[model samples]
Structures are given as C-alpha cells and as structure tokens.
Target: MSAHPEAARASSSTPQGKPRKAAFAAWIGSVLEYYDFFIYGSAAALIFPKVFFSPDDPATATLISLATFGVAYAARPVGALFLGHFGDRLGRRKIMVWTLVLMGVSTFLIGCLPTYAQVGTLAPVLLVLMRVLQGLSAAGEQASANAMTLEHAPENRRGYYTSFTLNGTQAGQILATLAFIPVAALPDEQLYSWGWRIPFLLSVVAAVAGYLIRRNLDETPVFQQASADQDVARMPLVELVRNHWADVLRVVAAALIATASTIFSVWALTYATSDAVGLSKSGMLWASGCANAVALLAIPLWARLSDRIGRKPVFLTGALGCAVMIYVYLWAISTGSYPLVFATGLLFFGVVYSAANGIWPSFYGEMFPARVRLSGMAVGTQIGFAFAGFAVTFAARIAGPDGDNWKGVATFTAVFCVICAIAVATGRETHKVPTAELGLRPAKEPAKPQISESVSS
Candidate 1:
C-alpha cells in the first residue's frame, strides 16, 4: 500500500493524538504573550507620556512615548524573517517557548526601570530597547501558534479550532485591562511613581504560565512529518518566496483586518480617557475589557460561521461593519456619552471586529502550503501589522489641536479599512477549499487504494 500521509505525521495532529490538548496549550500560551504585548500599548497610550519621559514639553513627551510603542513594531518584520524560519525549521513549540521567555524578561525589567526624572536620558533609551526585543519575539508568536493549531486541526474544522488562538488573545486583552483597573484608580502621585509598575511586574505570573503550558505541547504533525521524511526545505524563506509570493502578498493585504484590533484596543482607549477628552481612565479601560469580554464569545461564533458559509463573506461583512461603526464609536467618545461609548465599543470590537479577527487564523493559513506556512504567515502578518503599530502615533498627529475632530481619525482608519476590504474581497473563498487542496497543492483525489483478494475467492 502507498504511504498514509496521516499515519506518517507524528505529534498531536493525528486522529489518535491529542489535537484538542495541543490547541488548548497554544491558546493559553498565546494569551499570555498578548497580555504582555497589549500592556505596552495600553501604557504608551495612557501612562507613558506622563511617567516615562520628561513632561516638560507635553507635545514632545507624547510623541516620544508613542514612538516607544512603535519601536517594537520596527523590529517585528526583521524578527519575522528570523523567527519564522526557526518555526518553519525547528518547529512551533520552540518559538512559542522563546517568545514567552523574551516577553517575560522584558516586561519584568520594564517594571523595575527608573523613570526619566530619576534616570534622565537612560529611561526612554532602555524602554525602547525592551520594546524592540518584545516586537521581535511577538512577530513569530501568533503566526507560529496559528500554524501549529491549524496543522493539528481536523481538516474540516480548521476555522473552528484555530479560532481558539484569537479567543486566547481576547482573554489576554481582558486580563491586561483588568490588571490596570487598580493601577488607573491610584492617585496621580502613585500612578506616576509606582502604580504603573504594578501591572508591568505581574508579567512574572503570565510568563510562568505560558512557559509551563507551551513546553508540554508536541511539535505540530506537519512539521514533524516533514522532518521524518526529510522533506523540510533547506531554506524556508527562499522556498516561500519562489513559490508562494502571490499568496504572501494576499495574506499581507488581507491582514489589514488587524486594524480593527489596534483601533479599538489602543486608539479608542487613549482618545476616550485622555485629560483632553474628559472620560475617566478606568472608564475607558473597562470599555476595552468589556468589549473584548464580549469578543471572547463572538470570535468563536464568527469562526464557526466561516467553517459553514465561507471565509470571505464573513470577513467582508466584518470589514464593512467595523468601517461604518468606527464613525459612531469615535463620535461617542468625542461626546463623552458613556452609554454610547460602551454600546458602540461592544458592537464594534466585541462583535464586528471579532468576526474578522477570529476567522483570519484559518483564512490566512489556508493560503500557504505546509512547507512554508510559518514563513508565509509571519512575513505577511508582521508587514501588515506595521500599519497598526504606527497608527497610534499617526492618529495623535491627525487629531485636531482641539482634539475634537475624531472624525479625522475615523476618516483615516476608514480609508485603511476600505483598502483591507477590497484586498480580502479579491481572494479566493477558503471555506470550501479541501484540506489537501489548499496552498500550492492543486485539487486532487485522495491517493488511490490497493487491495488483495484472498484464496477463499
């Protein structure tokens, strides 16, 4: 008989292996990494301008704080090329473990750093370095985890299974936001002096949990099978570029859907709570925590829907929904309508954006063959996410001096949203793409069977 493709695959991807267990571990691991990541975004938006830098020039201080947040993103594309190769070469588990370690160390050290007043120029300089390290580690974390989970998943259920990754991300965002509830409530003296550090220091627990969970996960079946068969590409980056360039471009463009994540989680949080806006700090954070809380459920629902109807329709619906709602969400923030803020945030981040965010794990992975899945996804996503990381600084610059023209921010975000919609709209529908037919493999029948007749005949 011919080789059993499924039988040759080692690790947790086989029918008999613990696919669910592996996915669960990936979920928890990713959740922890994102918790560390979102905290920097949260701090940059709300606290860094006040505490990390010299506040003597308010405008320069804000710009510098925002620049620190962008530092990590600057390192991400570079990190992606290296770590993506590692994941595609060494397997996903190793990359996941390394990411958790890098993020944890940086966050803990950040908690211990001296502010600008105490350390002068060294404070911001060190902060930028830590953020760069974090960006590098993060560039690989989600892409590798998504590929691992997708490879282990049952062919028919890839979308449903991989949705857990983003669900974990929402859980992380929720935890990070919850961590700040107490910190944001502290007095100004405490907030600037030490309360901010409290959230950063809690990285210890998250790192420990991520380490323990990720260490136990088996390498993905696809990667294991490649190694056993000695079919692993000599250079995954070159292989991906040579054969999968179009798909890489498609994935990059489609990944613009992530704009929804940054716009809601980072931009909206800052705009609503800034002293210029009059909304309380805790109020905005709760809005974020609550919206993602709802997203925890909505993300899975959208993925399940994609598993049924198709990835494109659901994704397009989400893109359009968030585009229109950004207008309303921004308006609510400008007016200080707490009810409007919560309602619109929940509707946009929790429901609309979740549709796109949750579905993309499967959607993007499906575009590449296993030989270059990590390389393709990592490169595509990080390059696309560059816009998101930069959007915070750009949005602030775009904000009118009066800071009331959030309509300008909405317009900027909407143009990007429309671009994302058009890009994804052009891609092939993956909900019906058979497991074996996805990526570089054209559609074909299952390998033919061989049988022998017994003497009884």
Candidate 2:
C-alpha cells in the first residue's frame, strides 16, 4: 500500500478559491446534460406513445414507448466503463466536454426524427439509437462533475460543494417540465407533430452555454498532483475492483434511490393522466416542475445539514420519509385532488428526496481515492441507475391494462427507497473524516529502504 497523491495534497490543503468556481461549473454542466436527458422522459410519457407507436392496443403501445426511455439506461453501464476510465486517467475536464457534446447531438437528432406515421418501422428504431447516445453521455456526466467538485472542495465542506451537481439536476428537471407545459397543453395533433420537438431543440442552447462554462475551468488540483507524481492508475477499473469493490457495491445499492425519481416523473405522470385518474397532463407537469423548483432550494439546505450531521442520518431521513410520502402523493393523485397532489408532490420530491439525492455525489465519491474515484462512482451508480431507467416499464406492468394501480406503484417505490436506506446505513460515516484519509486502508509503518552495497562501490 503506497501513499496516494491526493493525501499529500490534502495534507497541504488545496487552494480554496476555485472550489466555488468548480462547484458552479459542475452545477451548470449537470443542468445542461440532464436537461437533455430528462426532456426525453417528459416526451416519452406525454407524447411518444401517440406519435411513435402503433395505434392498435393503446396499453401495449404506451408500454413500448416508455420502454424506449429505458433503452438509454441499458447503454449507461457500458458508457460508464469506457468514459469513466478516461475520466480517471485522462482528466475530468475532457470527459465533461465530450459527454455534453454527445448529449446535445443525440437530443437534437431525436427532435429531427420522423414519427411512426411518417417513417413506419424506422421511426422508433431511430428513437432508440438516439436515446442510447443520451444514456451514454449521462453515464459519465454527473460522476465526472462530482469528482471534480469533491477534489476541489475544502475538506469540511465536501457535502455542501458536491450538492451543487444535484441542485443542477433539479434545475434541469424544472427546465424540462417548463418546456413541456405549453407543448403538453397543445392540441393532440400539434403536440405530436411539432410542439414536442421544441424542447429537444432547445438543448443546443444549454449545450453551448454549458460547454463555455466548463471549458475555461482548470482541472482539479488533486488530479494535477496525481499526474505530476506519475501516480495515475493505468486501469482504474482494475484497481477499483481490487481495492474498493465494497464501496462500489454500496454505491450501486444506494444509487437505486433513482428508482423513486423515474417512477415519480414518468410513471406517475402517465398514471395521473390515464382516464381512471383524469388529471390534466399540464397540471401534472406543473406539479412536477414546482416540486423540482422547490428541490433546487432544498438540495443545498439538506447538503449543508449533511455536512453538519453526517451523510447517513440525513439520507435515511430522506429515504424513509420519501417511502411514506410517495404513497400519500400518489394516493392524492388517484383522488383527483389537485391541491393535495401539489402539496404531497412538493413534500416528497422537493424536500425528502432531495436529502438523499443531494448527498450521494459527495458520499459515493468520497469512498475512493482520487486515482479511482471517477471510475468507481461512475460504474457503480450507472449500473444501479439502469434499474431506475426501467422502473417505468415495471410500474406500467404492475398497474395492469387500465393503469389504475396507484397502490402497486407506491409499494414498488417505497420498497426501493427502503433498500436504498439500508444500503446507505451500511456505509461508513465520512463527514468527520479528513478528505485525505477517506477510502484509505489501515495504515502500517513503512520499512526503511535498504541501501545496496553496489551503490557504495
């Protein structure tokens, strides 16, 4: 066991000035990348079943359309392995740039794709291809952004600094919902034909803005020091598996928390709009947007609290609270009570879910040293997130043909949250640990190097 370069940098302390800048840059990049990713979820729920799928057997069409959204998740683990390796070895700055470009191009192409009416079987095939690219881009974006922030952050403030990446995620969801509201409000013909494409097209602007923001920032000092010391891992995945497999497994289980998100955003939206519930698509979109808007504020607050109290307690509070609150929220939607729907949505998604969502970036990244941090978090979280990506399909099946099984969806969501909480509980409390000491094996005194007699000769 040798000393890691990040440990030496931590002993001296990284410069404090750029952590804020790095956090802001990470925040902006996430907003852009996730905006590209989430807008597809909005469309898959609201527009794609009608526009891209067969009209016969409406229930099956909707399931297939939603399944296309999950196709991206299938690609994520592969992208994580490929991109995370480069992120750990080559540098975070380059990976961030490439992922953003890939997301932007994929999203923009999705907008340009012809529908089932226009292109027959070719339409959905093209749709799935673009979605795979979006998934690939997303696989690396958050992990790399988080690793950059964690490396730059002052030791005591890691939670607060890393929270910005997730705040940006909330912001992106808000933007995606807002973009969909007017389009979702359109007549069925216009919405399916053209209005829905507008949000995907808007991704270009986010791409340009995010690229400019990330391009000028310097690489994190931890990475710079690792490079200077010639200590960069040749194969980060190999090293990570050998030394940090338990942390990766913990991160995978904890990352299943994303299941709650997709269910709320995708499945719940579809369920509310079904004839059984009769909630307006625009209304549900507004509820989601408002929840995410509130989350943008709540994420940083929860993260600051994690910094003070440690990660697991705040995270468990969130995980368990969401378990209870999602039931109330979905039940409210089932009852057709708009006020109750909005209120519960805000509480569950905005407040409770933010507790876990905001903290995981810091908590997971801190489980590895700089040499393997990006690869470890990326591979672990992406594989877990793949489960979340398909949660909508599972919820659709559990709800049956009429889509009225709010209780089943709620039970599914709550169970996922419980598992996530248990996973978080099993990990070490890292808030009080020095940044340099995190993920370190127990220390042993190094034997003094023996002088060779040949050197004296």
Candidate 3:
C-alpha cells in the first residue's frame, strides 16, 4: 500500500529526541502505573488474606483475596470504554496524566484503609472499591502509552521503540517484587501492621515523576493530522464494533498470552509457598525479581529482533515456548530446586515469554487506524486481560482435588498460549506496513510515473 505523503513528511521532519522522549515518557509512566497494579497482586497473594478478611478458613480467605485482585479487571473494560474515548478524542497526553493521578490516589488510599479487625466486612468492601478505581486507571494506561510510542516511532523501528512500554511494565513488576522482599521477611506482626502499607504509599513518588515527564510532551503528529482532517470518530466504540470486530477478537485472543504472566507471578508464588511445595516467600519473590530483571534486558533485544524479522515469528516463538516452559518451571518449583527454579523462571518468563511481551504493543496497535486506535487496543486487551486477571483463580481451580496439580495448571496455561499463537498467526503482517497505511481495508497502490511534456511533444 502507498503511504500517506503527509505522514511520510512528518516522519522525515521528526525531531531527533521526539521518539526517545515518547519512549522514555511511556516507560516511566508504565512503571508507575504497573507498580501500583502489581503491588496489589503481591499483597493479594501474600498479605491481604489475613489482613482484609476473616481468619475463619485460610483457604477461603485466600480465595476471596485473590478474587478481590480480579475485581479490578472487571472494571477495566468499562474503564476502557470511557477513558479510551477521551484518549482518542481529547488527546493521549491528557489521558496519560489523568490515569497516573487516579492510580496514585487509589493506591495511596489502599495504604490508609482500616483492616478487617478494625472495620469488619467494610474492609473488604472498601478494598474492592479501591481496586475498581485502580482498574479504571489501568484501563487506559498501557493502550495510550503504546499508541503514543508507536505513532511517534520511525516506521522500521516500531517494534523496538514500542517495546519500551512493556519494559516499563517489567520494571514495575521488579520494583513491586523488590519492595516486598524486605516486608516478606519481617515478623508477621510488623509485616502485617505497617510493612504492607509502605509499598502502596510509595506510589506517590512514581506518580509525581510520571506526571512531570508526560505533562510537557506534544501529541503525535498522526493524531494531530487526523484531527485536522476531521477524521476523528464521534464514538470510537461504535466505529470499532461496526468496522473492526475481527481485529478486536484477534487482540482479545492474543492478549490471553497474559495467563502465563499471572500464573508465573501470582499462582506460582502462592503454589510454591503452599505446604505441598514449601518454598519460602522470600525465595519465590527473589526468583520473580531475577526473572523480571533478566526480562529487562531480554525484552528490548527480542523487540529489536522483531524489527529485523516480522512480529509474528518472534511472538509465536514466545507463545509456544511459554506453553512448554511453564511445565518445566513449575515442575522445578514443585521439586524445591531453587537453582533450577530461578534458571527456568528466567528462561520462561524472562526470555521466551518476553518475545510476545515486547512485540505486542506495536503488533496490536498497528491493527487499527488512528481514529480508534486507543479505544480498540484498550477494550480488546482489557477484556483479554480480564481473563488473565482471573487466571489465578482459574489455575487454582484447575489444580484439581489436591490443589497441587502443577500439571493441571501447566496444561491450562499451555492451552491459552496456543490460543494466542493461533490468533497472531491469523492476523495481517504489519511490521513492513507503513504507519500511515496501517488498518486501511483496501491498501492504496503507489502512483505511476508521469510522461514528460518534451517526450509527448
């Protein structure tokens, strides 16, 4: 397809720092947003059961706590519907700034809320409410960030540039895990009483930094031209449903790849610490930290490779690799082999899974036009991620009668990874498609050379 002349010109005129600035802003913003998100997941697995619910049955309390973690995901699609509209209509920077503030406020409030001892049933209720708000904030964070980075990036390097968003996500998970390491070590009394609150409150630092970084950046020229051309949709959801339902379904299926992450991070943590396996909480957290740290290096490297190759090959390798490796990693943890656990975790989550993680922003964002890009990505991914959020509960259920069936959980994870690979295989290749021509139904052909006046005379 022929590229848009204006967009090509805009690309040529791009300032040296624009792409880097966009990538940096996205990375920092994502780190802050996900820090707030992952810390809640950590607490759900490690602390919330005892502090937010009754102590009647440990298993039931744990279930309820993990369910609360899933509640945020319930609100995400709804949040995406609204936040994505504003992002597509108003501007990416506006949505980015607002989401960070909302996330910070919600996380800080979580730090201040009273415990089950003090508030009875109200504690869990308020926790759910705050989680919903966090969900709302998170709904738009990554989609907008991905759109911002992808649109600003050079055509051939979109994979590498857009990857900074996931890199930020990994950094957030690493920071959240590191933040919990010391707290997880404390005596139960001190840990539950105050140590748990420390991480939640520290989100303010990330909030401030993300806000200042995003506040000054200009909107993407693609979006600016869309506005000038009056190409912006009045209701992006309606447009998305009418024109691009297939692509939306593709994103949702592709996004299920997240089950691997939730399994690795939340389900695996809890399972490893259960009596059946018996690893220390600190050891699991450290293993998670090491995997994420390696992902920091591996994600960008894979992303750069995707720039050279197509996005599908790299993504499929990761998806299918994750399907096989989940078993290996879980079996290692089941055997209480810490060294093997660390090594496999790094390979599975860090290297193999990272191919999908790093490529998805550019891969998925390219599926829709600028008019509905933010809304399409937000809604599709949030829905898919909703399943991912509940993957913890589902894996727990899949663990069977004894609740230690690593095989059952691994099978469940592998099934979904296969689904993601299938979805990606069905989509059009966008790595070589110009940013301007992306998402157009019948791609326009290049102009033919004109005959000279002298030759005609």
The global C-alpha lDDT for each of the candidates, from Candidate 1 onward, is 0.83, 0.90, 0.91
TM-scores for every candidate against the unseen true structure: 0.92, 0.95, 0.94
How much does candidate 2 score in TM-score?
Answer: 0.95
- Pairs of colliding residues, candidate 1: none
RMSD of each: 5.9, 4.8, 4.1
Best-to-worst TM-score order: 2, 3, 1
**Regions of candidate 2 where Cα sits further than 4 Å from its true position:** 1-10, 13-17, 445-457
Residue 147 lDDT (model 3): 92
Which residue pairs of candidate 2 clash? none
Off by more than 4 A, model 3: 1-17, 443-457
TM-score, structure 3 vs. true: 0.94
Looking at model 1, residue 262 earns an lDDT score of 80
Residue 15 of model 2 has an lDDT of: 47
lDDT of 2 by residue, 272-369 (tens): 99999999999999999999999999999999999999999999998889889878989999999899999999999999999999999989998888
